[model samples]
Target: MSMLGVAAVIGVTIATFTTCGVGLAHGTGTWCALPLVWFIGFPLAITNALIVGLPLAFLFCKLRLTRWWQFAVTGFICATPVWMELAEPFTSVRWAQFGLYDSLNCFGSGLAGGLAYWWISQKVGIRRGTDEIAP
Candidate 1:
């Protein structure tokens, strides 16, 4: 896949996960619904990535961060908005809040996402007819 294509996938995935994290964090239900948000979430995720991920990728690249570190960083970066949005003081339940789980999820999601992007891009290679080339 081209960088743009890969970016699209990453963006979408990031958005989806972010939405899930935010939703799970703020939801008051016994259990969170994961599959219900795909329609709206996919586009939102991709758009978010395109809008946010591109600059992030460039920044990471510029900083000369390793791919593994980038994934960790990317996940943390992706979760920031969610964290910020859910920062309102809770008035009811205080046992388990969204912050801890959401933060962890964001970190994990970012690590996985970064690794996937790096792997896919490396596997796809830079030239046409050589997508099979392994990095």
Candidate 2:
């Protein structure tokens, strides 16, 4: 639980920075957008962490599928639906109209977030009963 919270914070921070970086690249108001991005991204990231990530984590544990690549793939898969909803690809007449840049942003964030969570969990050693597994 605490791990999830920490991972969420890290994920949100990465996302906020990514957003600001993109804005800066476009010569937009990057600093002015920082607060808004953090405020909005934090809650959503946390919610996604709980609603989607938690169950997947448990399932991975149960199946002994704790590889780093597996987590990265899971993160990418989880982010896809969220991106679709945000981009409203279904609502658009041309699916190609969906912004590839935004998709990449979300996917990258998710991948980083998953890797962060996996690294934290490994470092902290997931507790199963009295045995600690660091795999």
Candidate 3:
């Protein structure tokens, strides 16, 4: 696999660990939920990659949207209520139970996730075709 791809996986894994770890701590779950968090994280990450990450990728590729503010705003908007709303039905959770803060938490998490990805991509370099741009 490409180094960029590997870095994405590693970066997302770390982000998931920290985000979910803290989320479970604050949410209506226990340490016993850790396994489930990990279980849910990877798939949810794929959902985020598709639902949130894709547009960002498009902007990055087509529009060359590389600004930090662009990433943060785009990531927050896509990942906050939108990702949750879209992905919720696929998950077992009832939408009625979610409050405003849940979205805020998701926004924060998505913001961090995007930053994590950007930082990792910067460190590992971004791939465009078979060649990569060195950091």
Candidate 4:
């Protein structure tokens, strides 16, 4: 359950971030590749998500912070600085093309990830015992 939840969350997060990037590029009059870029990027981002998010999740688990808020806050905070780093290489004009929406996208993605995590865990019956007699 938790595993699926994490997978879904990471899936959505990567999609959202990559879309945001493409959208920003397009908004700024850049030659943004839509379908082609998504085709290439999603898999790579998913790999990164598993590689990175899993360890971070494990750490959160160790800290007894596996709840939604914990994941949400952790994901948001962790993601925001990365956004800043992404902005660093771009010119001020291009960076300004995104502005607050970039941060919002990150926050929304984190929130969605957290909710998906919690929701999947609930739906998958992982916390429920297997010993109950079937009616």
Candidate number of the best lDDT: 2
Q: What is residue 16's positional error in candidate 1, in angstroms? A: 9.0
**Top model number, TM-score:** 2
Deviation in Å, model 2, residue 86 alpha carbon: 1.2
Runs of candidate 3 exceeding 4 Å displacement = 1-32, 81-101, 127-135
**Candidate 1 residue pairs in clash (backbone atoms < 3 Å):** 15-45, 75-110
Error of 2 at 80 (Å): 2.1
Candidate 2 per-residue lDDT, tens place, 12-53, comes to 577657765775687743353456546765676667778899
> On residues 59-125, what C-alpha lDDT tens digit does candidate 3 reach at each position?
6756555655666666566565545564466444544444433444456556665666566666665
Q: For candidate 2, give the lDDT of residue 54.
A: 91
Pairs that clash in candidate 3: none
Off by over 4 Å in 1: 1-30, 39-44, 61-66, 90-98, 126-135
Candidate 2 Cα misplacement greater than 4 A, ranges: 26-32, 89-98, 127-135
The candidate, 1 or 3, that scores higher on TM-score is 3
TM-score of 3: 0.54
lDDT of 3: 0.54
Q: Tens-digit lDDT track for model 4 on 1-135?
A: 346345544645564666567666668553334454346434443444465566876665455454666666655554554456545756676567665555555455555555565556557653422334355
Q: Tens digit of lDDT per residue, candidate 1, span 30-102?
A: 2434464356434444555556666776665555444555555674577456445544454424325444554
- For each of the candidates, give the backbone clash count: 2, 0, 0, 0
